[model samples]
Target: MVTLEQVKHQCRIDHNDEDTLLLGYVAAARDHVQRYLDRTIYDVAVPSEDPDGVLDNASIDQATLMLVGHWYAHRESVSETSMNEVPMGVTSLLAPYRHIGI
Candidate 1:
């Protein structure tokens, strides 16, 4: 998905204190997006990794970043701010990559 630096840049953080935490969020976000699309997204980190069932596209990457930003901002399940629109955007980004029943 996204790198820790990318996540930090997205979240506008200027510190390295939370690199591990941010990396964790990145992994979780990547997995979540992959699951939502019902397929594996390509992993650039592992160049030797299998390419089968993998999607290497910008939308999926952006969606993953969006999710990480959202999760990073809102750590808790519940928040005072309404987040009903975030998922819609993520879905739209992942829609093309999403597998539908035939």
Candidate 2:
């Protein structure tokens, strides 16, 4: 997870402004999602139980699906507020994969 201090330091250099909690939160959120996808999708492991339930326990397809669902559920509110704007880059990256319905 990206720490507040790390985010603040980067933000200060990027935005040339003082560190703010909100900025740190945004950065951390993005970092968290990216890291989650990277680890879950790239690293695969066998399911301890119900092997049949998970076709490929090691792949991250399920986790990605879940994350996508969660994002879609919150898209409306996230799109509405300027302060909470989803990072454009991240949103763009996930756009093509957005399922039509939850």
Candidate 3:
């Protein structure tokens, strides 16, 4: 649900060469957050999306951006440095939205 401008701003890149890649990160991040939450973050602007979120869009947006930042920072699965779990607070932000079932 984040934009190219936001992703660029987050990654501190001012060039457009990686716009497509950045945008891809946005989508992947959205999917990642959605899957984690087991719920959809509704955007009133998107007509087909159901407005069923109990939380604000900003929470989801922030969570997605957290993921985007992580994925953007680490492009390769095999990092030169030690691996870390998903960026801090990703679960913290999305946990409230998680679907708890019987």
Off by over 4 Å in 1: 44-52, 86-88
Give the number of the best model, judged by lDDT.
1
Which residue runs does candidate 2 get wrong by more than 4 Å? 13-20, 27-88, 96-102
For model 2, what is the C-alpha lDDT against the true structure?
A: 0.39
Estimate every model's Cα lDDT from 0 to 1: 0.77, 0.39, 0.75
List the lowest-lDDT window of 10 residues for candidate 2: 51-60
lDDT by residue (tens digit), candidate 1, 6-49: 88988999999988988999889888887887776765542445
Between candidates 1 and 2, which one is better according to TM-score? Answer: 1
TM-score of each: 0.82, 0.24, 0.80
Clashes within 3 Å, all models in order: 0, 2, 0
Give the C-alpha miss distance for residue 100 in model 2, angstroms: 4.5
The candidate 1 region of ten consecutive residues with least summed lDDT is 43-52
| RMSD (Å) per prediction | 3.4, 10.4, 3.1
